[model samples]
Target: MVKDQGLSIVHVCQSMDLVDSVVRRWIKQHEAELEGQPGIGKPLTAEQQRIRQLEAENRQLRADNDPIKKSLGLLCARTEMTYRLIHQLQQKAVPVQQACRVLAVSRAGYYQHRRRGERKADVVASVQLKAAFVASGKSYGSRRLCRALQAQGVIIGRYRVRRLMREAAVRPVWKRKFIHTTDSRHALPVADNVLDRQFDVAAPNRAWVSDITYVRTRQGWLYLAAVMDLFSRKVVGWAMAPTMPAELVASALCMALQQRQPPRGLLLHSDRGSQYASLGYQALLEQHGIVCSMSRKGNCWDNAVMERFFLNLKMERVWQRDYANHGEAQRDIADYIVSFYNCTRLHSTLGYLPPAAYEQKMAAILPIGVSENT
Candidate 1:
């Protein structure tokens, strides 16, 4: 066979090393038949092989930079294939937990496509818009929805926010979870309501709200509890965990307390979730000398501030982001809450100034004007 094909001494060893003895004997016999063959075993040089591999990698990187290539879903689909191996390993219990650690996908997405039974609706366009909006974590709402739809080159009424949501049955994730967190049923003396749903207040740091939201990641769903200063509509502190333990809620509250150092009687309000109603949570509130209040059970309106925050989180950030693992989800949520939401987000309550900017402006003027107690 070696003689029948173009094979020589060195070429035979390199090509069929598994049968090296046979290959070598064949080559020797062929060589004995003809002492020296013309040109053989002249494969690519080491440098040439390296250059080809490098060029292949460079080509892929360049492809990634081209927006059309990436957005057309060709590049994205190709790139996501790397995750397939991890998923395959997971199927066999390989214990490789990518858990939103490596990816950033919208958890609430119905990207799964087909459901058990298909429900066909005439409003295809509306359905598409709703998917995008919910994918946006409801952050876009009506106005942002209009802008996003326009960007997609679809000229439709802004009112379609509600319409599309209803059609898709994909309402924003945290639309007032009737499942309360704080247990107001306790006999422990509850503090009187001072804020009393009065979200609109002058100046800054006068009022604050707290609530919890959840995000689904590869590891599992991570629950996030946070406290926001209503004056600026900014998140002050937040904690995330694989489990929604009471400490998770209190830790976030403590972080906020240490950071803001609100006045002697800052109003801390939240729902009747046990996390808030527990002795530890209530004690933390009393320790800070702040008044405590709970929204009436089964009432979403009483905690509108937190409800709005949850709505924003579910609709804007969590809806659009997919976490590869738990760490990524936790870290990303922290950035979204602290970096963007608090400092850059425009609050309708603060006359459009971001929470941080609103607070800074208030601190600048509070000594001379707006003499009012929170």
Candidate 2:
């Protein structure tokens, strides 16, 4: 085991706790043993051990970098596995240019392949479908993605879109829901639930729904107050603060008032939180002559549209990150509202059109005076 076989006698002695002579004698007695029968012992010094570890890691890295070495399907099958390979390379920090060059694939062609996923699918349509899904921040499932794809003149079925999503390993993000915190126990005055879950509206500002939700950040919990125009399911106004106060919601209402300037009797509905019930918020609504509507006591379903918006917000954006402070969360939420949700996201209730686009399309066709006042 030592001298004759050229084994590390010192390592054998230390590991087996035997004298070198004893190992030598044992080797002599076991002369019939095949050469290289027992493998070499572990590296003796820490540096040598580290070198061994690095060598193993280097081998793993090489296998990862060379995608074909790990999965033969990457080149030949050339379908879902290809997307997975590109994704794996991306995870390994391999540049897209380098990956395409090594794989002998054109960059544009490879992306088209990766996006479509299945070889049988229409490559262009699949790419467009994936583009829509990704543009929604992976928040649009097959139903919405299909609608978006059709809007772009790429007609595809929902189940087919679902299959492509599975092939691409793409899924919408989901967030854990917290308990509803509407403080309906307050002694403040509350109004009737006039909105009555009638989410569909013919015009932009016939009614609006508002709600308050919280975001967790390192600094503290940041509260978000959003007012959504029911007609278009658009977040017309929003405000964020470290505390849940009447002023937060009032500010959101004020923003909506300034932005829309709808007729005096526009219905504004919200949960019976103390903020919405406060004289300040009520007076702001009164000043604009907006009708006040509240959800039934402890019933979140009454404000379902606004609740859905909050659900979308947390699942798609806020819950995905660990914000260091309220400022970061506030900035991100604002961007999500203005840049994505209002402008780009597809609302199922509005025939898959985004809020802004739906409003614009309606205005283009409907008579001028038939918009808000209706």
Each prediction's whole-model lDDT (CA): 0.68, 0.83
Tens-place lDDT digits, model 1, residues 1-374: 45577666467677656467666655566676586554344479899999999999999877876765456465457435534544565578765434323343332222232121123332656766776665454555565565656657876676765566565664544333333344456655554556678987676566788887777787777788988877667788888888887799899988987787777777788877767777888888778887887776667788888877876766567666778888998887887777767775556577656688887787777766553244
* Model 1: lDDT of residue 335: 77
After superposition, the stretches of candidate 1 with alpha carbons farther than 4 Å from their true spots are 1-190, 367-374
Residue 355, candidate 2: C-alpha displacement in angstroms? 0.6
> What TM-score goes with each of the models?
0.52, 0.66
Residue-by-residue lDDT tens digits, candidate 2, 1-374 = 46557769788799889998767666655663546355333337998889999999999987777765456654466645555677799889999888777666678887786656556556666688778877888788989988888878876899988888887778998769585556777899899989888887778888899999999999988998989998788888888998888899998988988898899889999988899999988888888888999888878889888888888888888878899998898889999999999999988788888889989888889876787766
lDDT of 1 at 317: 73
**Highest lDDT: which candidate?**
2
**Residue 126 of candidate 2: its Cα lDDT?**
68
Q: How many steric clashes does model 1 contain?
A: 26
The C-alpha local distance difference test score for the whole of candidate 1 amounts to 0.68
